[model samples]
Target: MSATSVSSDRVDHLWKGVRAGVPIFVASAPFAVLFGAMAVENGLTVAQAVLMSAAVYGGASQMVGIELFGQHVAPWLIVFSIFAVNFRHVLYSAAIGQHVPHWSPLRKAVAFFFLVDPVFAESERRVENGKRITIIWYAGMALPMYCSWILMTWIGAEFGSQVMPDAHAIGLDFLLSIYFLGLVMGFRKRPRWLPVVLVSAVVSVIAYRTIGSPWHVSIGALAGILLAAALPPRAALPLEAAAVEEATS
Candidate 1:
């Protein structure tokens, strides 16, 4: 393709990613708001809470961080906790890297920073369909979600006490669980996904009750990874397998 055509295609894909990410952003908003509210309740100032949201951009890890901060945990331990919670990103990067081998180091670094669950999902879907994935497309999906998270965090910090005095009573806290459930449902048809998920959940609950906090997340993820690695590789689905399977049913 000519330079102009390539640029246009990139822009088109970028918007496509943005559109795909909108629903995820909506689904995540409640959690983001709750994170902010909880951060403030844990003694974080509005600025500190918002800054955490902007810098970390991982809702689960940030919430853990806030809890640790409130407990006066050692700074290094807090860092480790956040790292453990976010270690799954390493796997996410590895999976997406296959499609962008020639990306510049700077582009790769920026992309990795924004590589959240929704962005990774959309990118993986595109790659599975043999579509070209571009940095612009990934950024398009990431930036808007990032902005929404930060904005909601600020709102929650500023008004949570008054507006959401009883967030739990209103079920705001359950939104993240529902959102994650929806994500997991999407992969239900994939081979071996069930066993992996079940193992992860069982291990995670045990770890949470015994070891506690960030360790549970890391342990659960590692358990899933190890189980997956031990399993024999499944055959790749044919490009039209989804359509064929759907039509038969």
Candidate 2:
């Protein structure tokens, strides 16, 4: 391709990623705002609140951290709690790393920083569909989401209660679960995913009731990983067989 054409393609990919992230951004707005408000309410300054959103972009962990901080929990315990909540990022990084094995160290570092759930889900979906993902494309998805989160967080810190007096009453908390469910459903056709999902759900409930807090997430994820490892890999369908199956569907 000509240089101009290649540049155009890159821009197109970036824009496509941005478009893919829009729904996630919308879904996350209320939660981001809530976090900011809660952070300030719990004794964080507006600067500290926005800084947390900017520096630590993991929403769940940020919420947990702010809550723990509010309780005057030991700093080490707060850090450990945040780490436990976000340990799943290690798996996400491992899975996506294969797609960019040739990336420079700097590029890899930047990519890891942006490797949040929505970006990972979108990028993984594209990869599964056999599309080539560029760094710019990934950034397109990540940067916008990051900006929206921080912006919403600041707004929440500054004016959350006035604007959203009852964020819970509006059911904002359930949006994340619904959003994640939609992402999970996208992989329903993958033979191994359903079993893992079911197993993870069961384990999560048991762990939540017993171990509680972040342990449930870690236990559930480990259970899913172990189950996936033990199961035989599903064989790929032959081209003709796949065509026939597609036609029947």
| RMSD to truth, every model | 5.4, 6.5
| Candidate 2: tens digits of C-alpha lDDT, residues 84-198 | 7677577667777878877888998988997877777777777778987788888888888899999999999998668766767976545556645764575465457778999
Estimated TM-score per prediction?
0.71, 0.70
Residue pairs clashing in model 2 are none
Q: Considering summed lDDT, which 10 consecutive residues are worst modelled in model 1?
A: 240-249
Q: How do the residues 1-249 of candidate 1 rate in per-residue lDDT, one tens digit apiece? A: 799998898889888878877987897798888888889988999999999989999977887788788878678988888887676577677777777987998889888888876777777777778877777777777889999999999999999878876767977656557755765676567667888999999999999999986567669978987998899978856534432322222
Clash number by candidate, in order: 0, 0
lDDT of 2 at 154: 96
Clashing pairs in 1: none
